[model samples]
Target chain A: MRAIVLASRPVGTPSRENFEMVEVDGEKEKLRAGQVRLRPRWFSVDPYMRGRMNDVPSYIPPFRVGEPITSEAIAEVIESTTEGLSTGDLVRAHLAWQEESVLDARFATKISSDPGMSPTYYLGAMGMPGLTAYVGLFTVGHLREGDVVFISGAAGAVGSIAGQIAKTQGNFVIGSAGSDTKIDELKQLGFDAVFNYKKSAPKDALRSLAPNGIDLYFDNVGGDHLEAAIGSLRNFGRVSLCGAISQYNSTGPTPGPRNFEGNVIRKRLEVRGFIVSDHQDERVAFERDMAGWISSGKVKVLETIYEGFSSLPDAFLGLFSGSNNGKMLVAL
Target chain B: MRAIVLASRPVGTPSRENFEMVEVDGEKEKLRAGQVRLRPRWFSVDPYMRGRMNDVPSYIPPFRVGEPITSEAIAEVIESTTEGLSTGDLVRAHLAWQEESVLDARFATKISSDPGMSPTYYLGAMGMPGLTAYVGLFTVGHLREGDVVFISGAAGAVGSIAGQIAKTQGNFVIGSAGSDTKIDELKQLGFDAVFNYKKSAPKDALRSLAPNGIDLYFDNVGGDHLEAAIGSLRNFGRVSLCGAISQYNSTGPTPGPRNFEGNVIRKRLEVRGFIVSDHQDERVAFERDMAGWISSGKVKVLETIYEGFSSLPDAFLGLFSGSNNGKMLVAL
Candidate 1:
């Protein structure tokens, strides 16, 4: 079995040279009782992985050099030595970027059979990406029925779901995307307003689209988008800070939105930075609600999948370039 | 009777020349029904008043040129035609920078006298200034028993009270003031650590003082102070943004602290800006708790009283220069 390892720490933007594929000796350790051996069918290459590439302190531990990078992967159980286990069961596991993995049964969760739902959904919409959108919008953004929401990276996995959820709740949902196709897709997804941030800027687009002001801002891509949101936010507004994909590769400090603290006092705005782990208590509610939305066709999940495990680095680098429209995934 | 009026809207820092002392014809209105005539005894000059000087949209309307600057003031009911017959009664009124004011009786709350406390205490420690501190610490900051609190503008009206309150609640309170005298005053006020921000940067001071990082930041001063708090904050830390005194006079966008939004993802910090008016529902609880703290000698009030009605603008101008140690008030 082959696995991808970090060859060296990235200076600016990571490249293909930063990764090395090596064969893993899976048979070196025999499976113990309550253990399972699996073959990964699908894996995720998220923008947040860029943070782990740096050898700095963050919410999660950084990926060490010469070690296999790990993320959420949906796998098929090939062998199991645990009770009530089957050979063909589909499970979600925190495994490495490898073709095969062996771990304790406790570390993996069996994916329940859904007749029409694809198993890759476990790696994107029904997994971390889905929950990230749910927690950011409802929990952090404090979404209400009549709120005017402006979301950056609107066509991405989380933003698409967030926009649909906001529209379903009767909010005036406005979103900004990097491409004309993404903008059209967002509008088709029932977003009240959608703009291509790459062609123009969010500041002017927001001004014309939301003549009134944004009540809640869901920030995914930071920098200029963040500044526009801060400027457009109404009094007593809220912002759910998710990710700053624009600054992930910068070696030095990026000048923050120049007027961030300026409006905070005069407008009484509340800006919060959060992780999905903090709101794990809301998972039961989120899954139940998201499932209902997905099945009812009220919320849709779109994904961009890359074939083969060797294309993992390409799938990740695509995030910075805005090549992938929705959730970027790699199939093993 | 005389009153001070804003001669012109200030460009940057307001000066004594910007004010005009005008004689008021108090008898001109001829006390209508449901009205009370009051003699202003103690009027406050707060930092928030500076934001109102600019003719821009904010939480409150701007202070109009040729009009009196209005703020929280304690007055005595010298004449009244209202149902509650009162003479020489202390009351809290939303009066302008004037010697005498005629207002609807409903607008003022009659303050009951304390056995040993001075009536002017109502203008400083027991009134809006006190409530600002109380609400910012308990409701906004979510102060815990063991929280290591960093309060900027520590010797001012609200910050002084906030530091003592945090210490009384068994929290490790650190404060930053402008003067060495104020630093000594904060030490006497039970602050665990006190630094003169004028002597050195808060970034260096915080590094040595709170090497482990801070739990909560009560921001009264913005710019460098706020930047330092964000950098030194612990994971999952909270910031109760009460004021941003540093950027009040800037004509253009000031360069904000770099990399402020960067750590937010990994550290999961929450920064909320709030006005005291937003938490008015907590007034009853605040007064009950604060009165106990004051009466039991757990907290103390400090005031820098500027004598006479002609000194209103001088009292207000002194705030920016750090000439006043505690609450800057004008006595009539």
Candidate 2:
């Protein structure tokens, strides 16, 4: 078995050399009655992984050095002491970032793959990112029809799906991306307005698109974008903070808004911070709805797949640098 | 007619010299159809009034230099040409800093003296301050029982009542006030914990009382108290921003929080900016519940009454300088 371990904590932006690939002996320790061996099929490398690498305190604990980097992935069961799962069974597991790993049967969910659609779709549109978009927008954002929604990082993983979902739900969707190409991609995906944040100031772009004011802002990249959204919010607006990718790699202070308190008072805004995992209770409904959206061609899944597992570190780092569109996944 | 007006905006804290008493001839056109003459009985002198005096953008428009300041007050309908309201009826109206004034009959709410409570109570507990406390904590904060609440400006109108309400609803109430007298008063009012913010660092005081963390924070004084509350918040904490009295009279640039973004993400907190008028729909329920609390002695209302309409400017200025306890009202 081979695994990638954290070489050292990077100062600012993490690089490929920060991760060292090492070969390790495989272990088949005495498996409990319900344990199973999982062979990596497809693994996800998301922007949130950057937070895990930092040794700072956050919502979750940071990854320690010389530890296996874990992520959500689709895996195959090579052997199982479990009753339901057997040899050659395909399942979704969190035992990722490695060639092969053993996991408890309880952590692995047996997934049925459709012949027309690739199983990778489950790690994206029907998986965590899709659920994140669904829960963060609908549940946390409290999105209403005809409400103007501005999504930050609109061309990437959760943001891409969030824009499509908001559009499908009859919202006036506006999105901001890193490049003109990504902005065009957002427009093609039915965003009513899209801006290249790299070219235009987020505040100015929002002002022109949402003249009346943004009713719901789904924030993926925090810092300046969050401040910009706060400035453009109408009275009684809702801000669903899903991520802060912009400041994730920064070692220095994240600059706050000049009128942070003023905006909160003038708008009577609700700035709620949330992670998708908080809505785990809504997963059954989420999966059924997301699956319907995918199968009916109402929602399109975009994947920027990396070729091999060894490139996982590069794929993960690409998220912080805005180098990938839609979901960034590493195939083994 | 006589009125007190702002001669000039103050640099740091307002003084009596910034205001001048002026007299005007009572030469107004007779009520054509639906106007009334209001003799203000108990006028509100709130910290929010200081915000209006400055020529700055806020939720409400700032008062012009030479124009008479207007605020929420309790008045007597001395003369009326309108239906539903009669001469000698007490009403709650928006008429401040003036001895007498003619206003539209629609702006007044006729009050009943049969309840036998003083009209001053209407300006404090049964009026705007009570409603501010109620809507801010219950409606916006969604404060649950057993939640630990930290209130800034805790001896003032909204904060004092808010602490009581949180305590009444079975929450642990910790309060920060300006002086030893105010801190002692908070203790007398049944606050679980009280600190003199003038003498103690707000963050340290709050940390000492609420070591675990604050669940609901009713912010009246912003700046340091707000930053402190952010540091003292638990995961999923709720912040109902009712006022920013600390910055109302600040001549220099207001300081921004260094770790605000970190605070938002790490705690997954909900920080809501609120202004009282937005929750006008809750007034009926508010008045009913607050009046019941007052009548039943479940809530205590403390007021600092500055005698005579001539003292309006001084009373209003007292709010920012920490001279008033509970609700500050001027009696004419």
C-alpha lDDT values of all predictions:
0.87, 0.85
Tens digits of per-residue lDDT, candidate 1, B1-332, equal: 78788888888888887889888775756789989989888888998888888888677888888888888888999889997848788888889887778899999998878785777777778888889889888887889878999999999999999999898889999999999999999998899999999998999999999999999999988999988998999988999988888877777898877787787766888888888887788889988888899899999888899998877888888999888887888888
Candidate 1, DockQ to 2 decimals?
Answer: 0.76
Q: Write the per-residue lDDT of candidate 1 for residues A1-332, one digit (tens) a residue.
A: 79999999999999988899998875756899999999998888888889999998677899999999998888999999997567999999898988888889999999877765788877777888889998999888889878999989988877888888888899999999998888888878889988999877889999999988899999898888988888999998998999888888888988887866768866888888988877878878887887788788888778899999999889888988887777888887
Off by over 4 Å in 2: A30-32, A56-59, B5-20, B28-35, B54-65, B80-87, B114-116, B250-255
For candidate 1, list the clashing residue pairs, or say none.
none
Q: Candidate 1, A98: how far from true, in Å? A: 1.6
Q: How many clashes (backbone atoms < 3 Å, residues ≥3 apart in a chain or on different chains) does model 1 have? A: 0
TM per candidate comes to 0.98, 0.93
Candidate 2 on B1-332: residue-level lDDT in tens?
Answer: 88877688777787887788888767874775798888888888877777776777767888877667787788888788899888889998887477788888888888768464788888888888899999999999999988999999999999989998888898899999989999889999999999988788988988789989899999988888988898899999989998888777667656655567667766888989988888899999988888777788878888999999887887887887788899998888
DockQ of each: 0.76, 0.57
| Candidate 1 chain B minimal-lDDT segment of 10 residues | B21-30
